[model samples]
Target: MTIDEQQASVAVIGLGKIGLTLAAVFATNGYYIFGADKNKEVVASINQGKSHINNEPGLDQLVSDAVENNQMRATSDNVEAVAHSSIIVVIVPVLVDTANQIDYQMIDAVVEDIAKGIKKGSLVIFETTLPPGDTKNRFGKRIEERSGLRLGTDFYLAYSPERVYSNRIIEDLEKYPKVVGGINEKSLLLASTFYKQALNCQLIEVSSIETAEFSKVAECVYRDVNIALANELAQFADQTGVNISEVIVASNSQPYSHIHSPGIGVGGHCIPIYPYFFINKGLNQGLTPLAREVNDGMAAYAISQVKKEVGSLANRNVLILGLSYRENVKEPTKSTTLLLIDQLLNMNANVFVNDPLFSDREIHAFGVTPLSLQDKSISKIDIIILQAYHDDYKNLNFKDFTNCKLLFDGRNQLKQEDIKKHGITYQSIGQQSEKGEW
Candidate 1:
């Protein structure tokens, strides 16, 4: 099929952030899109023009526009989604197993389903981020053999890695450049044509599929390493009684260098996991001691800082602010704040959690009762840890926190003056509060 014909039907497997956003973008650009998910309720909600996630504006409108115009819909059956389209995109989660090894179960299952129903001359593009050589080593041959169609001629395959955040999925859809590569020239051309038509941004082509896969991993590895470095520096400055935030901001004044701010630890899915993907692959090929050591040590270091702040761990009422991975969104995947909570509980600290964006149901399942800051219930808490720097918490009065002697600013959320006036002993990332007895 040619480019125009290729634009006729597009199937997106796994209706998560990447998949759903791609579906909405393609459908709005005049392609008929089909989405599939294992969750029955999510599929039902999409089919009825609704969204299961929040803080993403205009998703409902986009879903409604697509369904009303007969451009998009959702289904629980993967076979139906595959059979209905000439271009199929697989985008499922690639999580770590119990032993911290890469688990290919979700992607393997989707490939099996697609292999059964995909047509000859069809295009299969993978948007899921995996370890390097995953397409060439794992899924590529398995898919071709199962379908009984010769790749490069009878069928096609490509890799187009996704680059967008959870909260800004829509805006980034039109902003970031899209990268495309294929098993062969034909596959690359076909996939490129499809993306160029829908996306209103730049498109770059690479030499091979593996190059594209490595590039995707490279993008994330850079972030993970830098964040780990920032966290390390933050810890060092804290020990030396120096403020790292001010240091970074001052250094950023130079036009050439721009450093990322330090945080409690790196969170979210891609940044934390992608570095391990490369490091593990490196270890299999040879030794990868440095990469493994720096990234793996980050979470534990953040937890140690929390321990330092609380002074006495036993029977302390600790209020944790921010349950999500980052501020302003409700996605909690791979949240370092949650890791801190788990470590604190192991040390026998009484924990109370709160996040403005997350629901009570989500918090209760974390084995803690959600506390309302509005009710002045913070009076009884012995320690307050600012895990997320949400906008809602920025201008909050430190006087309300006067009852709490210890304030641990995980994201550097507390101001210096407030810390001084309240006479509270405070700790923040890359920052120093006047040391006082708690």
Candidate 2:
């Protein structure tokens, strides 16, 4: 079948941020999209021309326009979506637990649904990040077994990792190069053709499906190790009265150095999780796991600084600023603030949380009291840790924190003298400076 024949309809099996964005982009580009998800509310919302994710730029309008134009629609039945469309794109999430093992419960169920209805000559592309060869060995085998069709012959299969940042999926899809690979030449050709025809993206075709899967993990592992190195150097800089942020800038002035900034911890869906994917593969487990250990240890280090400045943390009231992993995004997956909260609670400190993105009720779900910075009625706050540097927090008056004795700059974002000007002891990772400047 030709590319035009396959474009009769396309199935996007996962209506999450990345998946929904993919469906909208395809529909906008003049292709019919059948977006499938297990969540009935999400499907119903999409069918009503609504985008569930509010923060993603251009997604709401695109999805609305697509549904209005009869280009894309959503359903809960993956089997129906697969049977109706010739091109199937799977973006189901695969997460790792505390044991560093892949939890295939969600993705496995989606695969079972796909295998039951996947048609011959239909191209199946997995865009979820996976351990290097699991696309072929684990999921591909399952599909072949359930469908009774041979890969690279009866049907085509490919792997293309979804390399997108949350809240910027539409922009990243247009800008970043899409790395793609397949089980065979035919699979690669069809998947490449579909992408080229569907989206305005530059494609980097690789040698094999395993390479494409490995590329995404390697990209994230590089960041994880780089951040770990910065965290280690920050500790050394703290002892030697040198600011690690300045060190990072001076070292990176030359094009050769590209050091990542040290923080309270490395959080986010990609950086904190991908290293474990590599380590669990049993391929050179030395530095990767060690890096995870170093990054995760930063929360304890921050609390130790609190202990140094304000005596014991027991019975002290600690207010954490920023719950999301990153400053601006609403996502809270693997947030470092959660780690700090855990440490503070273990030290018997009463924890209060504040983030402009999350509501008071949502903050309470994390088992912490929400302290609005805008609240006029002043309350006792012993310590304030700046985990996320949201713009709304830029004008934070230390006077508001009169009872607060310490202002810990977890992201190295706050000014030191200003913090000290209010008699609040300022501290951050490796931020030992008489004159505090970046």
Most accurate candidate by TM-score: 2
Q: Can you give the lDDT of residue 348 in candidate 1?
A: 88
In candidate 1, which residue pairs get closer than 3 Å at backbone N, Cα or C atoms, i.e. clash? 243-430, 244-430
Q: Scored by Cα lDDT, where does model 2 land?
A: 0.88
Q: After superposition, how far is residue 319 of candidate 1 from its true place, in Å?
A: 0.7
Q: Each model's TM-score, in the order given?
A: 0.93, 0.96
* Candidate 2: regions farther than 4 A off: 1-3, 433-438
RMSD of each: 2.4, 1.8
Question: Model 2, range 1-438, lDDT digits (tens) per residue?
Answer: 444666569999999889999999999887899999999999999999999986898999999999999999999999999999888999987888878687889999998998999888888999998999999999888999999989888888999999988878898998999999999999999889888877879999999999999999999988888999999999999888897888999999999999999999988778888877888878556778989999999998988877877789999989889999988888788899889888888888999888999999999999888988877533488888989888888987877777877788899999887888877778899985433333
